[model samples]
Target chain A: EFDQIHNYFSLNPLYRASEMRKDTAGLQAAKNNMSTKFVLFSDQKPFLLRSEEPSRKYKFAVFNINQLGTELLERGTVIFLGLETWDPDSNAWFAVDIKEELSDIGPKFFPEGKYATPFPVTMQMEPTQAGIFAEAHSVLCWLDKYKFCSTCGSATKIAEGGYKRVCQNWECSSNKGVQNTCYPRVDPSLIMLVVSPDKKDCLLGRQKRFPPKMYSCLAGFMEPGECLEDTCRREVEEESGIKVGRVDYHSSQPWPFPAVLMLGCIAYARTSALKVDTSELEEARWFSRAEVAQMLAGQHPHGLYVPPGEAIAHQLIKSWVASSFSNL
Target chain B: EFDQIHNYFSLNPLYRASEMRKDTAGLQAAKNNMSTKFVLFSDQKPFLLRSEEPSRKYKFAVFNINQLGTELLERGTVIFLGLETWDPDSNAWFAVDIKEELSDIGPKFFPEGKYATPFPVTMQMEPTQAGIFAEAHSVLCWLDKYKFCSTCGSATKIAEGGYKRVCQNWECSSNKGVQNTCYPRVDPSLIMLVVSPDKKDCLLGRQKRFPPKMYSCLAGFMEPGECLEDTCRREVEEESGIKVGRVDYHSSQPWPFPAVLMLGCIAYARTSALKVDTSELEEARWFSRAEVAQMLAGQHPHGLYVPPGEAIAHQLIKSWVASSFSNL
Candidate 1:
């Protein structure tokens, strides 16, 4: 029932496209048409921009950031307000549940993840909300930890729609793009569901941060100069201590949860032994096909489950249990 | 006979999995001891370290750019070298052939788009040199274009092993990583081999840039909010004016050619007619399985051929011809 409710809630009309497009040329249309008021909140506190104060604006430039309007241009702008949320559930600052919108604001934003589709929901913050939030949050998270150039210890700056920064030291010359900031993006990752040799069970693990009774696939970022199988094999071996052979990809999902391309695969276990690494995992274990079926149905005996509808993990696990690999 | 040469030329081994770790801490054991250096040039171009004196001893950073060396390491001197082809057949630089050796005479010079890889392959550009070249060249080429911040018009520097950059605009919040520098590294793309209903023929298209006597899958990048299928459907319609229905996942490739994740699918064509978008493509036509097989084998009676090996399009076409869609 909860899953059913979840399904209905995700039926966002603003982004209800049957398919996605790579070249979206109409984002400028939405930006101008949808310039509304925004309350940028930090840690649940909202930052209000007062009138008569010539709205302070910031442009986060991503080179060729796919704007889906009028020739599929990629340049755009977003203004952010530093407001905290008075949130009750998390007991944090009052945050606006932008993804869980109950009201419809005018201005057709791109809904589909692909071209020219307006964003599914309005954050009710700024007209250019999600674009601003995602760029600022993901890039800044890296910047905070990377204040000085790791290579030369030179100071760096935030430049271009918060997309890039340059080195001051004349001796230091490094060029990096604002990927999550600039351009349309795809971040390669290795994620998979490991199956038992006998075909009766599958492997599942839980992170410490997961919901009370949820278990999803194990995943890790791909290293440079490596193929997807190499990544899958390496990640599975490290995370679960289970040897996998002949790893075949099932599908992929554009998981923009802070920017990652989740590459899903189904691997056959070379061995049944589970040498768990507790430090890496809060817990790890195997589940039967029947048990997995229940979890997908939300009828688990322990009320255990997989990821939500938006996650490819859920779709992947379901595909495995039903033996339908083309569901992507 | 040429097929054998074609096959041999195609089996490029760019990166070999140097090691595998059973657990996280096992990374220490996997460190420098695990990975192997890919031999870059067939002519053995040695990487050199810098010294003020011409007679001084030199040290070159050559080997697989192992992640173990880079994961916890943030600071290191990186050398950036622009491309200059060597005359492998003539023993000098003038008679340069693109297929010959690309020497890395590393004086440890730095400019941009040059960082230590997860594996350090100084000279070993093999089997997939084209793909490898595409990865390094495209990423660096794009970075070379952006030396300053577009926001407040300031400079930027590289950080995090050239994985990121920062702006010099102190007043700009994103200057401190408050904004995005770019989107993610990989761009999600959908490239489908549209097959007709009876399965007697398949659809293939060629861009102007493709080599003569070749055909490959049609592809485009995924946009901001679009779903995978959503992308496939739209790209199919837009490119060839042939609407597609019931798109299913097949496989994907990490097309390092400028960091694109090529999502491969076999779509059931909803229309037999294809009105070519000459603006987007040079030719669009149908090829029988017999022709495809010949193309893969380069035995096409009409001299029509598929893409070279080491390409996702080549693999996709092969997968379809062999009916490689059953197990899952």
Candidate 2:
């Protein structure tokens, strides 16, 4: 049986609703809310504040919308994520991107000796902060990369209160549909743990850029005109020359190193050949369930390990261990 | 047991590899190949040619890459989709977007009174043809809409053999990663068949744009920082005010009405109440198993019907019917 476990970057109770049709009104109401908080990002990194609590060393440096002043508000793009339902008051949060303005203005609002400092979002933030940052960073990256109309190469303007970008040229054909040129994009990817036919071992691979001795499940983007399952199977065969059968969906996670939806799965391999494609992976091999358990528990004698708990790779490995060894 | 059925959009045996690392050389070689075929799209609609066979009425208007003159090649974007592995000859299919150059050039190469005409991709093309068109149309639409860099409003050029768009600005920060602006996007959405506790009925809902008396599964985009199961549950509750408990992924389809990857699922409902959200749906309610079976078979007394076999909704209803009442 497939078990549902907590995957990092996947759990955020704060986000609410898909199509915020009244985004303009929502943004205005959120700005005026007494409990509203603003999260800031510059160059894809979120600002962090030092935490007084010894248990947690860092805290998200969130500010009241009014504290930033009008110049910063007018300069950057504003994205309304959703209400923080975890708090009883259900206050809203907004992510502001000031990468461009920071260069021109030289951190005026972010003065020296301030309470907060800009830090890489990849570093651990509070769960809620991480979720907000993921959504905000994805949108900011999208807006940063898509300023001109694709249909006519003309400049575009923010519409629907930062949820969309409309082409400025009236005659641009991109304006022909309800979708138009302003659609936000999210890339979908499939990540899977391939098990040998006997179910005694699972496949794992490492990339060159990965930290030493860290191996993770194989993953690739879901191409156009194919289902998630086919993508998973295709990726396994391509990376390791292992043909997978009987694929099962495990869970999914939102990975925001610039936005990708990772669909996690377990696949029963039909073929056992291990021909690792060097172009895709540095090395790939089968690991016994006991080894995976040792890696998960940080007790592996060989100094090999999986990714930290913040990634879906760790969750997939942890779940497999529990399922395979729990009866013992 | 959820039987893995052959879903229409999901069953393209043609797609070869995900990342075409040698796309530049690959495209040139494919062009020189004797088995090369080109798929054409304009404004997201595919061009269709009449089939001589009496059994099949229409086929994709495929052209030899060499037949299209240098004029068309210079003006449009060419995306190298994977090879047709299903065919013994392994022909390569290319999706070409001539939207911009079409009107000004006035179909110069197309030739008036020809054997082909432009048609909405929604209309049924041959199965393999439809799949190719969906893939081609999606790539063309993306290229058409993303011609300009979002970060600096600069014109972006097609890179990675038409798979990516690179901002012309040399110092753009988006160029930092191994993957920059050129990644193709596929939006993930969840569509579920919510079954009653007793398994006697299932919930279905219709949008305002749906045909009269046509109801299908409830679906919404998987929002940022959400798992597929949660997205399914959230959409059901929001649309019909019905609470879902256990969610299982049934199958997936590539819904290239401008590139959405639809994840089909089955949900066991915990609450029976139906409160339709007018803004999202026109109506929603539970229907008996027999009624759903009739609708699937085109025998509904009220003239109500689900979508055709090509759509994932049809597959979901069909699967549910076979599972629930096949033995009866």
Candidate 3:
């Protein structure tokens, strides 16, 4: 039952053929195939097609290799997303960063296409499409940021079909051994719904950047040498001064605002004191079960609300309420 | 009860006062304090003291600021780890990379000290000391590798008391806004024990690097846009050609051999196949409960054995045997 919690951007349909990444000839043949589809990104913003038939929705604006010119195809960073199916004739999907060539080729290929920031655009797309967008965005952004090696400050060349980068300098430490520094980095973060000792209330906090009347679960990036449970407890105590006891894993979501995995958990708190760390949160307090239900249903008297249904925080709160805070 | 699994190098006792990291004056005073203890690392090797009175044991060879000497301290890359207690008069702790100054100061301050690689030495120390070494080793190694900014090929200066590094160039993109590239990175990996559909056996694999007759759980680093469950299933199938379904979270451990948070899980196999991917594993096979018990007890007729108690793999195996493959 817990594994059924599939948040938005979590249901990827592509078959990531990781073993085929090292086969340069196979990759080249796939790219040359006419059935291959390409998703385009410009400055981390995705290109979409607006649909107004049944209701307002967005679809990824995919193109063929021939549609994108040779120069754009060669110069842009192309990442093989995966195959739609495992069959030999299956459509090979890919994502390309068209930022440098967008100005020159935007009007020619996708004159009617609309580009928007990942968050808003992903919210309107279907679940599978959103998942694909998450993967593409994270990989493309990582490529843009890591043009040079962190080990020796030397330029690197992409390898393993965009899955890895290798330093050009032979003396770089990353080339000396089986180092993961050249791979796409994914930060694991903790997001928890903390229940009070008596189980009557759950703790929620609002960041300065959040909407005025919205509060969600507390989240922070995990540090080196700390387990997920330790991260959960530390984030709760540091941001809201709530001490957590037993932590239960709920589910996980891939938040690709530059690649982070949100580990959702239900933490039982031992202390009820509210000492908001001003530097981290604008306000933090416990909400009763009734108040939380109202917030989730958009019926809060003060117009307060939790995060949207697509967010893992929303699922955590909903799960806690559904279980009546038992057996968690 | 799952939280009781305190694996080796997982129980850090230091109170990480993260809020005080930005206060330069506070950090300076803490560093200059006489009671502050320093842990020294030379080329990622930790210095330790040997105790031969009773059973042979190893302890962290810690020194105060005065004993470390100002020249060595000034030239070395020092990191403020944490405090022993939250009290104002509590002792502060720090870890310093003495690679450059080790040759000059090694004979003077620690002539009797013995240095060894982290893995062998950690196996001999107490749990608390091993946990501290985990933290120190991970952070120091991270700092050594990240001498330059990943965003731009420019020199970087340490900030946030060794928790972060900022690019020196003002034009660097990392300086423009909040970026996690500056912080210490901890990769999240999935390690799992797979149970057969009939629940009569468990799957295990051994890489070429592993010792002879030793098979452990399958594990691989989580890629972007992948949840821990997805990672577990993918790694299992890829390494062993055995499909997995209905994954359950077990526990987590911080394996600080270059910083990784191991997310442990118990996965159920949907199919029982024996096609091993030779590139990732030398061999994989299903082991009966009796064989596993014999291996755990070191009584296998073939002389096969499981990992030691300090490893999470051993814990997973022990738990599975204790539960009779029922609820888990």
What TM-score does structure 1 among the candidates reach?
A: 0.56
Off by over 4 Å in 3: A1-3, A52-56, A103-110, A326-328, B1-3, B51-56, B100-110, B326-328
> What digit string (tens of lDDT, one per residue) describes model 3 on residues A92-118?
898878765464455467677777777
Winner on DockQ between 1 and 3 is 3
Mind giving the per-residue lDDT tens digits that candidate 1 earns over B130-184?
A: 3344334334433443445444435666443233456666675545543344322
Query: DockQ for each of the predicted structures, in order?
Result: 0.12, 0.47, 0.65
Specify the poorest-scoring 10-residue window by lDDT in model 1 chain B.
B90-99
Instruction: Estimate, for each residue in B28-74, the C-alpha lDDT of model 2 and write its tens digit.
Output: 67766756877666655565556676544566666775676546766
Q: List the residue pairs that clash in candidate 3.
A: none
Candidate 3 chain A: worst 10 consecutive residues by lDDT? A99-108
Better of 2 and 3 by lDDT: 3
Query: How close is every model to the real structure, measured as TM-score?
Result: 0.56, 0.86, 0.96
Those runs of model 1 whose alpha carbons end farther than 4 Å from true positions after fitting are A1-182, A224-227, A248-252, A277-280, A290-303, A321-328, B1-184, B299-302, B322-328
lDDT of 3 by residue, B149-261 (tens): 88898999998889999999999999988887799989899999999988989998888989899989899999888888888877887788888888888889888889989
